[model samples]
Target: MSQATELEAPQAPRTRKQRQAAAIAEAASGHVGWMLLKIGLLAIVDAIALYAAFVLYTASEWVVLGVVVVVAILVNWIYFSRRHVPAKYLTPGVIFLILFQVFTLLYTGYIGFTNYGTGHNGSKDQAVASLMRSAQERVADSPTYGVTVVEKLGALGLLVTDPEDGDVWVGTDEQPLQKVQGAGMDGDRAVSVDGWTSLSFADVISRSDEVEKLSIPFSDDPNDGTIRTPDGRSGYRYVSTLEYDTAAGTMTDTKTGTVYRDTGVGAFTAENGEQLLPGWQITVGFDNFLRAVTDASIRGPLISVTIWTFVFALISVASTFFLGLLLALVFNNTRMRFRNGYRILLILPYAFPAFLSALVWAGMMNESFGFLNQVFFGGASIPWLTDPTLAKVSVLIVNLWLGFPYMFLVCMGALQGIPSDVNEAAEMDGANPWQIFRSIKLPLLLVTVAPLLISSFAFNFNNFNLIYMLTNGGPRFDDVSIPVGHTDILISMVYKVAFTGQTRDYGLASAFTILIFIVVAAISIISFRKTKALEELN
Candidate 1:
């Protein structure tokens, strides 16, 4: 055949098997059922994201709303598109990682740099409103209005009737009083309003605390008196004790004649160093961090807690690892009788949840009626958890009991991984058992287990449950302003600072959290580098 004719010749048809495979791939790619499922799931996710965006918008959290919009758009683009198959598998995990891990860390870091605590948690507008609401005084000779309490959508409201004009209005703590049409009235008292269910006299009595505190503004202007119900049946007019001058940005106490001016520290301060409560959150560069190290009220307990945290973590890791390694070595022997039973018994502590075990230990160590003092020591009254030095010892002992089995399992696996030939060669060279283990076995075992030890150290550094449950982080420190104790580690201290006391300082707690992360990261990096030397021994 001529070369040009040969080049133009028809190719052989595809084999039946190859054609079948191609058909299957095509069908799989365009399957209606699979496509429908993907569409349904993505639709649900988008719906949720849109709802979240709506909520954020209502709260004026524009930054979070923008992020949600971007993420939802990216999700739709990645899943619907045919390109980036690997990304299709990875997108869910990546999204979760960003939401739970990266976003949380970044938010915490931002809080650490800001005044985001009890008195400084909301916008300035909210703070001003709160100040005006909190500093209210009853207006003398104010005419009382007949009123009835009502509820709508789990929110409480007051329906008031003007005795003279017979005009009825509905109002809530958040919403001002507005005239309502078709209100059900009973002898000049508004019994109910349209679109709101009237609360019965009995129901109103049951929520007396809420009813007494409910204050609804008479008008949009802050200067107007609010309608408040002292007895849930009658409403009275009350005006704020502090008068706010909006243009001048100052609050003047009408009765005392003292003025509080904005000092740019998230609060209005008087000239006498008195600051108002419920101040707004604002960015304060390094103030929380500086307070931790400089403020005497915080610095003393913080320094002591930091030192104890390091010591507790170090001792817990060392004690647990040593005991675990020793037991692992003994049980690893082939001729040991009932070794399986012994191993199971050793792992019993780990099999039970650690927190439950901690509670059990706490009960056993109680000074008043504890097993240790009563049974073991014949009522000696030794304080296992109350005394400072004794409490530290007790924590270490309980942690070792709870933690050793894990390390034992790790060491047992690592021991099996070590080659028998290396030990035999040392034996042939006439080295003693100790020398052989030191030179050949230990170094090799460390190659596998050193990383785990470092992780365990980090875990025990923030071992909050043991400290919190066992001693409640106390023998008690009387001198510190915040709630702190002798046995308090950094994490437990952070917990006390953030949640336990009346004054919750979230900004300070977040700063402590960041410090903890830095400490753990630095230790892990350094230890991992040191473990490289053990890897070389392998």
Candidate 2:
């Protein structure tokens, strides 16, 4: 037998099952996926703990938790991505989502309760609360003036001015303003009674301390001299027995026998002329919410702004999508030239920070000397940031410039992944390009891009930077109380109220924030449902 004949007794070939078994054995030897589950669980626990800590302590817990989450996800992805890549990549992002949400919630809650306003920017809470107490106490000691005086140069030094003296005299607080010995004086030394039109130092000083404590009789007390004002009653006002019950939410003025009930709003007023100013740290349960809902000023402009916001967002998404998709499709053609250069140029807008870009655009659109006005509207200004309609439209224009580049990039990536075979098959059936796009391409494209569309809408809804930077919600609308602007979105309006309003009422602002959150959340939920419906349809 030759060497070749030695292999004549051939062994049975290894089956697919045996090959699979061998591969598994090799994988097990490498300890592949060994720590994947543990790492994932640990990341999840850490993210939860961080969020809880933030809820308890606010902004202080994010650093450690963020680092741990990033490290864990990175390590797990490095090791386990041989099995699952997407879950590992998404782990860190999920943690960020939790952190962002917690921060927003805490911020909204903090702004809702304090008088966070102007001239009171940092004095949002404790500092402003001190003002009311200080004001109340400052008027406690009204000076009772015994005398008034004027100084002279010669032997006759002082002159006394008195209410009792038909012959006026001048004296100091130390010396009573009574009849003085001086018969005549001249020029600067003369304390002339002609200039004194009953407006003496005694009159002004008497009113200095307006606050006083007076005793009131429970009934008709003729025995107590008809319950008159105390002895030194010249310019002082007595405090009637008006009791304020914060718990019961009522104010009772015992003298007037009038009761002022807390209307659950900020104001407390009786059927009578009695009223109370908004005291410090008052938590008017649902007044903030009610004001947002029913305030006539807010209602009128709010409806218009809300409508514009939706319209603006819709237009933004549509224009960006169509334009981006068109650009992406054009770029995807094999015959296209300088593709890399074109891509870089197209993505440049997205590369820059959005706020900076918005500001640049705002300046360029300025009515007085902007390059845009010089080109289009000539010498006169266009009122880009002034008129309500023009400002809204201008906002949309700026937003479109900033937002479309991102959409374009996304569409470019998505367009590359779509197989040519589907298009070819449709073309073979004599389908036109538009028909193929409408029937086959768009449906498939939407499956990938719908989420991005929802995100784009959501982003535009609260796109505070663009609105703030470009127009600052101007020009002012005089119709409203406290001066709100035309293009003011809910967030910008909240900023005005909580951060820049007359009183810096953080409590009111917080209340507005909560309302806005609810509105935004509801909108997001609706969008999500719409997404789900599309997914099901697909």
Candidate 3:
């Protein structure tokens, strides 16, 4: 009576738990939740893909459109079916890799071969439209119409009232003038329309440039002219002063009869060597790359910037690694009290964001009314960020402050992982602390740390944020045509060329980028080979 049966033994508890788990599983399997979740996610993915396809189709990107459509169909098939289980896991990453990495790289390389700059950024049709628009002038004898600037669906339009016939009409850049029946009018001026909102005087003033640029077509044909307004109240007809010969690909000035022919270099040029701008994009084989190396204005600055970049990366790595190793050695001792607390303090710089830390240091280093000038130097005005030499020094100092903690953490881990027996054996062999570190510990440390040091060098090589945020690559070079500075690296120089200048020379910048990529790849390969040699020492 006191003993339990064999069936009700210690295994009964686990059996009961198993039964409960099975019951829960059976109930969960009966629910439609898992199916609904899968369907919902698939629906979202399909919707996004369809939207992208529609945009690509409208843009007439046939090759990319075909690829997208095929990919979308494949994705839907893979996820919905039980087959190709591995494909379901790999599809998302592969698609993202193609779209973001492969597409971007290809597009950039294509741009490098072409004159894809500010004036030569569009297709031939767009260039023609722009040229024609630039040649437009108001007809002196054209009748003025009473107009009210109105907006429909965020597009500017003219709600125009005819003076002679008193007919109300509305037109935009795309739409030809059309009758607006039953429209509210203030004598001769159109006050309101049913579907559009009239812009207030303040709104018109705020959007002055947009209102001035708005050209409402008077008729279906472009030759019929468009009505433009300077004040958004009165409109007058204007016609282009240039006529394009579509059959022969020439633009003729209507008044002067000067013919501009397509030079096959993007611009339409006259025989006397004048060119009409807003040119179409055209490929120029190796011209951009040649310009970077051969052009006198760019070549000299490029050489100086390249040298500075190498020096900066090398010094930054050396300084940070040495300092970090020193601190790590000091704290790694077992006899040292409060080692953990000191380590936490040592890594405090790492805890804060690097960008924010750079900014704070920037303020402190400011020549005027800064923390260092006012407090430490007694308002000495040290010109930390202004002078060329001091600016480079300031960048290095800030980078070391921001960078050393990472090196400290890495070196600390490497030092701790070294075997205690190795250190003890070196001591028994009559080796001093320095001798042990130089011969045994160093070789061992290099085996683990060489790869990381190479990576740190790579990171410092392209360290754009420090150069940009701290100095903005300032103390500008007086002799250069491009915007580069004493502290400017290759990446920053490329940025200034592509974006800061009046002409946004994307092709030249891309060419420079290709050069930079080649340099970095070569360095990484050679350094990695050296790192492999260190690994053999262990």
TM-score of each candidate? Answer: 0.87, 0.57, 0.83
Please write out the lDDT profile of model 1 over residues 8-74, one tens digit for every residue. Answer: 9998999999999997799688878998999999999999999999889966899989999999999
Compared with the true structure, the alpha-carbon lDDT of candidate 2 equals 0.61
True-structure Cα RMSD, model 1: 4.9
Q: Report the Cα lDDT for residue 197, model 2.
A: 28
Clashes of each: 0, 22, 0
> Residue 386 of candidate 1: its Cα lDDT?
88
lDDT of each: 0.90, 0.61, 0.88
lDDT of 1 at 213: 90
Which is superior by lDDT, 1 or 3? Answer: 1
At residue 272, give the lDDT of candidate 2. Answer: 62
Q: After superposition, how far is residue 260 of candidate 1 from its true place, in Å?
A: 1.3
Total colliding residue pairs, candidate 1: 0
lDDT of 3: 0.88
lDDT of 2 by residue, 153-263 (tens): 211112422223334344321222344454344332334443232324564345333212222221221121111122222322123345445466566655566777755
Q: Which residue ranges in model 1 land beyond 4 Å of their true spot? A: 1-36, 144-154, 158-171, 177-209, 230-234
Error of 1 at 162 (Å): 5.5
lDDT of 2 at 409: 86
lDDT of 3 at 108: 86
Model 3, 1-538: lDDT tens digits are 3365765666635688898998778856875787688789989988988988888986789998898788879988998785898998999899899889998988889889999998999998778767877888999998889999999867889998888899999988767799989888888788899999999999999999999998876776555668899998998988888777777788888899999999798988899988898998999989999988899989988998999999999999999999999999999888999999999998999999887888898899999988999999988989999999999999999999988888899889999989999989989999999999999888888888888888898899889888888988888998778988888999999899999978788999899888888888899999998788787778
| Residue range with the least summed lDDT across 10 consecutive positions in model 1 | 217-226
